[model samples]
Target: MMTNLQKASLFFLSFLMISIMACSRELSHDDNEEEIIFKEESSTGEPEHYQAVPNDLVLIYDGGAHRRIQWGKEHFAPYVSAEVNGEEKWLFDGFLFLEIHDGRGRGFASGYQAMAARKTEWENLLENYFAKGNGIHALNEQIEEMRKTGRVTGEFEKRKVVLCIPEPIPNQTDWGQLDGRSLQFFRKEDRIDACKWYIDFAEQLFQDANFEHVELVGFYWLAEEATNSRNLAKDVADYVYGKKYDFYWIPYFNSDGYSEWRNLGFNVPYYQPNYFFSESIPYSRLQEACDRARKFQMNMEIEFDDRALKNNGWGYRLTDYLDVYEKNGVFDSLKVAYYQGGDAFYKLSQSEEEADRALYRRIIHLITQRAEEGVD
Candidate 1:
């Protein structure tokens, strides 16, 4: 019974919640705001629902280096649907994007068939990462499911998919923060030609009915780069724009290059704030970096991986991260990117996982409530 208007407010993405009732559902944490409940009992002897969806644009990386997000999605998707303002609603619906393929070891690898002979041209790419398969059919199955059900709307609305095209230009050595060894394999001089080849391939792959919901959203530039990396693909901006794609790259904030990706016309630069532990939570510096992104018209990509990534030192707690920003009231001011939603919780222990879930669910509900309330 989720209304289209409430659903409209819900930015459709891959990770969906099953049950999100502020008042009824038990949350791991309580909100600072008073009386932040889901369904309110009306004087007329009926329950009036209140929580609206929060995400404006949520992206979920269902495809991992060596995994699928089936378990994660199972834990999250159903909780999003609930009664709102006396009507049943789904809080997670619009603008939700799924990572179908990165041409890596997983996800829609068969889509590489679109490249035709072009795939043969770059055969030196990583074996495990690029070995061909029928994974695109898996993507096709996802599409058929969505199309058959009209995604969350049942109106035959299309869904968006983030196709990962991770290729660096030629054998340039140095693999920076990205998995470039598999993605960056290209012959010298044939780089521009390779760009054109993939653009056509992407256009065709997305043009199919499975991707009808897609609009201005663009591809994930798998080539993660550093500011001073000698092998940076500077010319990619031109190629990406010429083909009219929103180049989404998650660059390290510590790099001098983080400031320049937007200027190069990649358009979607999701800056990662890695300086969290460099000192004792330098809020001012983080704000400075976020402010620079604002000036550049780019977004800050906050991967929860930033907090719980064991490889990244099991990072800071979510509340600690949000407290600094909430105090500064920076959520609305900055065009922040959540990157992939809900996957980081999978890395936590059972108790830790529950805590993380309650925290994020409440946070998203609060953001949605704030946006609905215009609480500035």
Candidate 2:
């Protein structure tokens, strides 16, 4: 029964089969992982300096400007981040900065109030609405009610507005004329306390931003002609963020302090060279503006109105602005942003049916052609 040759043959066959099975298992595992490994090697797993893309080239259509257009759609998504009803809009690696409005720069005013020793009251006030949705406006309303009840009071209504158009509003000041004038009931010596308090309050907002759907890139600041708000922005940058964020502002080209804005740590300033107003000036002295921005390492923003492009009765067609940038060779040389929507494509297309779909295609073609040309 114990044949040595037969026993040896059986042992060899068993070993051979085991080896084949093991080899098959290893090959199958390798087949499953090849694509994943290749993708990982291509997309990530290496240290690299981040390069800003056309994504940085955003189209900012605010409530004051593009009131009608909803930007949370595919057609516009390629151009810029949309302001939607819910903050569910998805743009990979997107960012939003609410500035002093939602960020609560006013609550810090209590730090300079006569009851400087009382911290719990103001702390409780901000803690209630510090991180919630539309909390800043809610905070403002609550503060207003508190003022009515005679429990608290602070800055005048005019200073409460963190951001505004460059034009002065009537009835803002004791004298209707607005300039580098602020009426603080407090003595000048207490102002330092207010600034420090404001900076500390803003830091909390930045911390809370980590929990938001759109991460806060930087704290936006208003450079109103009256207050040197730019300096305030710098103080925040120097103190809280340590110049680690992309500081953004839209400066009127004709305004002073263009170069100084860069020095003040405004790394990402957007320029609206053309306006929707009567002038809507075409690019005549554009090189000077481009040079000014380039000197400080910045770029210009291009406007794309969804309003009736039929004749641009207000002035030149918005498309003309893009064309001008492309012709002048700054389309790619400078970081370009596509500012979209003062109106909807449907209204502007004036088509009987399928206006939106048609308008979308037209825009895509224009932008695609421009990109294909490789404006470098």
Candidate 3:
């Protein structure tokens, strides 16, 4: 016969086992709830991947001339909330001029003073216009806002912002043609003076409260009638770099064009080689330019004219362009500027015809392949 104490001990052990099992079941239930909650929140809330770096192909459309605040509102603000290829992309404004353009009424002195006085107002206007409802300050702030809002949804992966400032209005004007020798003598003083003024103005703006977020400033050195594009590039380079400015853009073309600019001791960070047709310039020349730019720690950017593309009747295809770049092996880091505008490429939900689709696919494939190569 078993003792009562033994019976009582067996009952207690069984009860303890039951309690342990119950606790284990509750823990498993809690884990499942946590997973479900995480998934639901991710799916229902805003996207979290909009802040990624953009692809090599940055499409900058011409925004023309307008005040900084007005230009941002009319051009950049709309694109900030747009999604391209399933990801948010940044739109750069090409040919953005924020100058004080006043006629004889105000004169240069008064105009300069007025711009200086209203500088803070202009900055605030641009900030509010670009980053409203999102706690951001400059262009970078607008990008962060896009990321937080998840305004982009599609197949694209990164975002990058670019701002291009062409050469400011030249200071010299002869109003008529002069002999080559005479022209050189007549323009020398004015050219020097113009360079000084531009440098001083840029430096002043840098010190002022207006141009705080300007990452890259482009000084377009037009090689039209100038004795040497290279000389001009060198002079400008000395001025800009003297001010500790790093980023630069140079137009590259045939041997003459490239050599002239090269002679000026200016290194092209972004190469704008203009090649319309396949045979206009040998592929090797383009590659050489890219290699030279790379040696100087600068990336190559190829510019294609929209008019030429259409005139050539190549169906305005982007593949032809990509193929050339890919063949050169520099496609991985090459920056392509699409001249036609934003409609050249289509985003998700927008269907293009079969031909256009093929063109876009080629571009997308090349961009993806290059991006995967991990070249910044």
Candidate No. with top lDDT: 1
lDDT of 1 by residue, 226-279 (tens): 422234354655565566555556665544466666454455566665433333
Off by over 4 Å in 1: 1-65, 71-159, 172-188, 212-216, 226-234, 275-285, 306-316, 339-342, 345-354, 366-376
1 or 3: which has the higher lDDT?
A: 1
Q: Model 2 residue 76 lDDT?
A: 32
TM-score of each: 0.54, 0.46, 0.49
- Top-TM-score candidate index: 1
- lDDT of every model, 2 decimals: 0.41, 0.37, 0.37
lDDT of 3 by residue, 1-376 (tens): 3332343355445544433433221121222221111111222322122122233534433222232223233233433444345654434322222222222111111112212112223233223323433211244445545556766443333333332222222321321122232222135454444444545544444345342333333333333212233345566666655654432344433323443443454433345544433332433344445445444433455444333233344443244446545654555544444433333342311334465445545555555555445443
Better of 1 and 2 by lDDT: 1
Compared with the true structure, model 3 gives a TM-score of 0.49
Q: lDDT tens digits, residues 1-376, model 2?
A: 4232343355446544533433221121222331211111222222121222332333332222113333233233332211123321212122221211112222121111111212332334334334343333333333334335552222222101111111111111221111344523233322323334544565565465443222334433344222334334454445424524444555545444655665565555656553332232323434344545555554576555544344443223454454445544555444455444433443433434443434444454444444434433
lDDT for 172 in candidate 1 is 28
State how far residue 46 of model 2 sits from its true place (Å).
25
Q: Count clashes in each candidate, considering only residues at least 3 apart in sequence or on different chains.
A: 23, 0, 9
